[model samples]
Target: MTKPKRFHPFYIVVEFFNVIKYWVIPLALSLVKDELSFSWWQYGMFAILFCLFVFDIIRWRMETYTLTGKTIHVNEGVFTRKVKSIPFSKIQNCNQRTPFLYKVVGVTQLKLDTGMDGDDDTITFHVITIAEARRIQQLIQTKSDSLETKEQQEVEPSVITKEERTLHFSPTAKDLFRASFTSLSMFVVIPILLSLYSKLDELKEIVPIQWVEDQAQSFIVQQTWIMMIVLLIIMVCISFVVGIIRTFLKYGKYEVSSDKTHVYIIQGLLNESSFSIEKKRVQAIVIKQPFLKRLFRIAEVKLISAGGIDHSEAKDDINSLFPFLPRKDAEAMISTILPEYQVISTMHSLPRRSLWYKLSIPSYSWILSTAIIAGLVIWVPALQPYTWLLYGVSAFILLLSVLRKILAYGNTQYVMNGSYIQMKHGGFGTELFLTKRTKVIDVSVERGPIQKWFDLATIVTSNRGKPVLHRFRLSGVPIPLADTFFTWYRERDQEISIVNEDQKK
Candidate 1:
């Protein structure tokens, strides 16, 4: 452990794949830049890739990582020779991601983050053996434990002692089947096929969309409605099968467990990933139940940590715990893993006056839709015959806008206990945001003109988010309740030094 160690040689393959993945768009453009013919541009890209690959090998040879008792030292760079020394305590979260290829190569990627908002806050080991990764992480934990002061531990007495892990949640075959639909995994294929189709404009001779459309029309007329229904059923069947495969690949082999101090999650059938985060480091728990998920009685639960949860891909992210868990199961899982977080079931809705004030607000969407539709009808002579469709679209847009606002008014609610505050808000989807009062970094009460007229206000609470601040807004709350919300936040312990608006009070 005292000697510097070179990264696993297999990392070159990982770097190679990353180069191809990140440079795919540029590579694709080179092939089709001037009407789909290979040119010198492709050769230039190949030369660049070759140089990068050589540099990757050189970088692997030059870089070395050493795990000392107090700190981790990484010496990198060929010409500049940059060096980094990070203390054990500075590591906020450590993650192990084993993509399918990495698993085959007997190596995994390691990421140690400081949980701060900066580029330099993270150290990554692109490839390392499993044993090495665990040893490094264990050394960090042992050192961090030795450094914690007794008085600091006493002040935060909730910290649990080390204990063996206990499994809590895992999906079954039936669960996976249900998740395939509720997870909206079937929709993943649509965007992918559409992107490929968009890029295949040059292959119109091989696969003519116009010819396909004409054939579909002819089939519908010749075979009657029964055949058309059968075609739709077949398409739906294919999507369902695809959804099942996607869900199985992502969560078929998932597990959620907890030890004394940390919650552990492992998922993926092919590309296995394992994550560990201290229970105390969990800033918030986000429970989302979209319209379809609600109908299916399922929810997606994600633990928000200061280390920055990857919101971009829930299924691909290690932060997600068996996504598409049954609603009740999700609640129980949170209680089991992080008991400090409260799952509030009941909350108060906004005052009735708020709804009227919301509806009275001018519909700018209607005006914008009308202007655009009218402009199109005037500019396009062919569309002049079907101006009625433009009006219909405008009306539909207005209806959608109005309906969402109404849903928002209905769905908005908030409830606060001594230590936790829960807010429910969103249109067309239900988002249950629950976080401890001490975890909230910022709180602001806003009053708009409409809110003033209706004696209502908006209360926004901010929390730590991945590379950004996550804010939750509860609009159309009664002014009195807004004050209560503000007061509750102000009461956060003296140790939690926060700027306040005491003078305004």
Candidate 2:
């Protein structure tokens, strides 16, 4: 633990790709120059790449990280030297990712993060062996526990260290099948197929694009009903199979567990990723039921912490409890992971009068479309015969807008129990956001002209998200309830101050 260390030697390769992504397209096009000798720009490119590699070597020599008894120290700078030391007690989350490339090298990247300044919030070891990563984890755990014991001794001299980990949830094969279907991963293949189809003309020298298109049309788009039906069935089967493979690869070996202090998650079959977050660092809990998940009566639960999970794989959103789970399963996970917060089922719905106010809000889309249709009919006399048709389209769109508002009104709800507040709102699908009073940074009540007539108001609360502030709005809340929300948040001042004092201690 006393020895100084640097990143794995592969960092030179990493730096090349970092700059290559920007130059790859130009470089690829340059290859088509058909020049016998290298062009001047090509020479310049090689020189740039060579200089980049040399600088990376210099970087590899200069940067060194040391693991000490109480803190991690990193010293690295090109021109001017800089030093950073982070106490293990301040660490909030840790994640280890072994991407395909890293797996090939038998190494992984480790990230330790805190809830502090963005620049100094995270320290990452871009390349380290798995054993070294595990050793660092153990050090952080032991050091943080000892620090916690000191804090307890400040009040009443007692040490409590319980390292019992319990398995909370793991997806079964059936669960994976359901997740694959609900994820709509089949659509991923369609986009790939369409991309290849669009680019087929580029391969005209080898493949006949027109002939392929004609064949595709004859069997598909410009075909009889029976042929079209058969093609659709084939597509469905292929998409389903693709979705299953994708789901199994990504969600396979997924496990969720927790100890006395942290929630742990490890997933992926090949490109494995594991994340751990302290229970107290969680800022909020979001229960999302998208259109597809809602259809299956399932939801995805996400824990919003200051030191968030990997942001690059945004679709999977690594902080999520499980990308696919039933409502009951997510609820139970919430209770088990963060028992201080509760996921309530029913809340106060919007009163009938709120519907009138919502509907009264003018539809900009309807107005804009109606004007376009009118202009089209007037300018093009050829369209006079189809004026009724244009009007029907406009009416249908307006009807859809009205239907959406009705659905929104029916879904909107709000409730506050003690120190926790939950808000549910959306049209086609619902999102229930729950957070404690101290977690809410801001709260406001808006009573617009229409809302005033109905004695209704919109209550908005803001919380700390991964790297952005997340705001949730609950429309159609009674004015009296809005006052209650504001008051409840205001009461958090004393509690927040106590937490600050504890952290200072």
Candidate 3:
């Protein structure tokens, strides 16, 4: 057992950033200070920051953690202390997050996931040295291994040997290039550009935003076609650069491998990050393709594990197993990681009545909108002259909506084989959800009045997750298929329960 210890001395900087989040109002106030009438508001904001800083100092002094052989204990709060004791056996994931700033400070934040639905039950070390975080992770994993060994020895006295080998994968240069082109992460540049533009006041000397805007407007007025071409070229260049940077930061030298009991993921460039999860902790698998990625025949595979923490904009994105792989390669990778749940694409097609069920709402809404638009043009004398244009736009919108519904209906599928369940959905691109029968926490079959008349239903399966209930839905499924799926789930769950019991023995 290690003695209870305080965080690294440099961790106060990270604590400062925590309090800085509360300084947003003050920051905004400072930006508009010259325009404001009351000057005392600035002083008041300073007072607030000062108080928060003092509060964090006290909280930092009060917080302490200890790692014993079997558990990690955390004590929090300044006056009213709250203690959390997390057993190693309950831990599903030990993930380390190194924000860009944290990397500069040489510290990491450790998150301990316990297959729970809320953060209240999880334990976190907000700031610790990278070395200390890794040591703690190793200790917890060691304790878990010991505990499992003890249980196994108790269950069966006979000696048993299991094969132990490491299966490893690292992205090739070609893979990286493909992933960069296929990544949706370039969309991050939109927000980055917007943020910079918003703070143009701060960058007036460096950027000369007003001058640039004037130049662009003058060019557009003088040489419209040339200006458009130049703008398009600049946009493409910026997007390409941003995509390369994002890809390198995310997948550069990426390595994902699994040992006997744990899956390890390592990636990132400047702020290197690593994460590991027990094989048993994985709840579900999702294979996805964006419309553009699908055109390139690239797919992404992600493992849904229990983590109470939400994926906020500021947090690092979940690193999928393979960010961009050929569709066949992605399936082969899934088989390597989870052999039991083989990828099956031969799904039962829904009846033509299902199409009616899918398009019913959108079709009706389009009709109602068109009717209202036509009525306005016909009754309003002033708008009567532009009736043709209104009709043309309304018809286009109706056609687009109907086409989307048809595509989505045609792609949707539901399949249950043995202990595995899969649901495919989406319109332009497809999303395939795969999970074991034991992973499903709830099953729901919904039928509206219209769906009932058409003998169609929507089947939803909920799996374990945090904050949001992870749901996979198969809409416009035949009523019989829905019933069959529900029955299969019930039967498979029971069978899995028996098998689990046998494994325990």
The local distance difference test score of each candidate is 0.81, 0.84, 0.78
lDDT string, candidate 3, 1-505, tens digits: 7888988766666677767877775566565655545477767877877887788777778899998868889998887888888888888887777867788888888888786644455788888998999888777766666666877766874655443536567888788878887776666788888997788786664444898888977877888687789888898788888888888877885778777777777777767776788777788888998888889998888878776335652255454776788898889877887676689979877789888877777577678889999899878989988988888888898888888788888888877787888889988888999998888889999988888889888999898775476898888888778778878878866777798897688
Ranking of predictions according to TM-score = 2, 3, 1
Query: Which stretches in model 2 have alpha-carbon errors above 4 Å?
Result: 21-37, 80-82, 151-162, 198-233, 309-315, 378-386, 497-505
Q: Which digits, one per residue and each the tens of the lDDT, describe model 1 over residues 198-260?
A: 866656544457887689778778997787789888887888889899899988889998887
Which prediction has more favorable TM-score, 1 or 3? 3
Per-prediction TM-score to the true structure, in the order listed: 0.83, 0.87, 0.84
List ranges where model 3 is wrong by over 4 Å: 21-51, 117-119, 151-168, 184-228, 364-389, 496-500
The candidate with the higher lDDT, 1 or 3, is: 1
Q: Which tens-of-lDDT digit does each residue in 60-163 have in candidate 2?
A: 88988998878899887888887888988888889888877888888898989776765677788878888889888877886776665765656754553558
Which candidate number maximizes TM-score? 2
* RMSD per model, one decimal: 5.9, 3.7, 4.4
Residue pairs that clash (backbone atoms under 3 angstroms), model 1:
308-466
